[model samples]
Target: MKILTITGYKGGCGKSVTAIHVATYLSALGDVVLVDSDPNRTSLSWANRGQLPFTVVDERKAMKVVQGRDFIVIDTPARPDSSDLKELAEGCDLLILPTLPDIVSLEPMLQTAHDLGEANYRALLTIVPPKPSREGEAMREELRSNGVPVFSTMIRRTAGFQKAALAGFPIRDLTGRDRMGWLDYDSLGSEILEAIGR
Candidate 1:
């Protein structure tokens, strides 16, 4: 079993969105379970409303459930400094930190990845914008220099995601994709799996 944890230092960085998509896409290859470690239970609520394919557990009860699962995809809270976040991250095979291309978002992501390394956790970047601004490309180059393994595929900004969130559903279940978000996510999932050596 391979445990993949989706985490970030702040909200609106696409933590839950990436977790749900990765879990759904990974399940196509093997059995998978979604674990909600966010206090808000955002992933759980969406799963309940949409009746998604996998199961979601309460934050406090996740560890016990993790011990028994073949694959656990955790949606972690944005607070990277928390002891619980460290514990959850330590238990995983891979840690995924998603952030927008903005410098405000990028700085914390860099710091968190550093902290994860200090705690002996392996992490990678996600949710990078497709049409990056000048500063965004600069941030990517900076991350590369810092030795962070960024995915070649990025989750572009899109209204399809907003519609799916509003409807409490996954993008794969949504319609009218002028651009296919799942393709990006699937490619991302494959990269993450390979990175984890799973």
Candidate 2:
């Protein structure tokens, strides 16, 4: 199985949300399982509250169900200690770091990147505001100029994602405007599949 880990320096950057959606996309290819390593059990709770296409288990229970799955997505606690960072990078096929497009997120995200020192990973910009707000594009350009590996698809800011989280279902499950959020994740999943297949 290809193990993908979603982590970040702080909360509210869409780590768990990204993990769940990525796992859902992978389920299309084969069996997939999401392992919630966060002490908060965000993904696990989400699965418990609503119906998800794939299985979600706590890290403690993961070993039991992970076998034979084609993909394993992990949601890790924010700001893991230094040693844990190295171990996590070494243990995963891809390390996804989700960050908001703001100074509050950059410092820690840059630090995490510097600490990673060439680990196979990509930085995803999430909660990006819509037009008239240039934060998302600006951040993506800034990161690219610095030679950081970043995703071209950004998870735009929308109440749909929040609603999905509350209802414990993927954004696609919701009708109307909420489905727009699902499109963003679908683009991200396409990008991720390309990255991993390389």
Candidate 3:
């Protein structure tokens, strides 16, 4: 199974959201289980509030739930220490680091990449302002120049995401423009699959 872990040093960077959506995208290929490794239980709470295509279990219960799973998406706790981050990187097939486009968020992300050393990982820019704002692209280019492995697919910030979380549905499962956010993840999912050569 391809195990994917979503982690970040900062909170509110859409780590849990990205984890859920990615798991939803992977479900198309095979059975997927999302392990809520985060102490906050964000993924587990969302699953309890509504229906999810895949299973979501707390880390404590993950061993049993992970059996026969084709994909395992882990939503790790925010602010893991350097040593913990290194361990997390070595343990997962691909480490996904989601961060905002702003400088405050970038520092931790860059540090995370550094702490990961040679581990397989990619940076995903989340909550990117749409249209007139060029922050997302600008930051992406900057990261590339700095030798950071960032995804070309940037996730635009939208209220649709919050709605999805509140309703316990994947962004793709929503109706109308609210579901538009799914497009970003669809592209991201494609990139992730290719990154891992799956």
Q: Rate the local accuracy (lDDT) of all candidates.
A: 0.73, 0.88, 0.92
Q: Give lDDT tens digits, candidate 1, residues 1-198.
A: 888888877888788989998888887777678988788888888877766666678767766666655678988878768566677667878777777777676677667666655553433344555563454566667777877666666776677777776677778887667237877787887887777776
Shift of residue 38 alpha carbon in model 1, Å: 0.7
Predicted structure 2: lDDT: 0.88
Q: Write the per-residue lDDT of candidate 3 for residues 1-198, one digit (tens) a residue.
A: 889999988889999999999999999999999999888899999999999999999999999889888999999999899998888888889999998999787677777777888889899999999989999998898788877899999999999998999999999999999999999999999999998889
User: For every candidate structure, what is the RMSD over all alpha carbons to the true structure, in angstroms?
Assistant: 2.7, 1.1, 0.8
Which stretches in model 2 have alpha-carbon errors above 4 Å? Answer: none
Pairs with steric clashes in candidate 3: none
Clashes of 3: 0
> What is the TM-score of candidate 2?
0.96
- Candidate 2 local Cα displacement, residue 15, angstroms: 0.8
Of the two candidates 2 and 3, the one with more favorable TM-score, higher being better, is: 3
Q: Give the Cα error of residue 91 in candidate 1, in Å.
A: 1.1
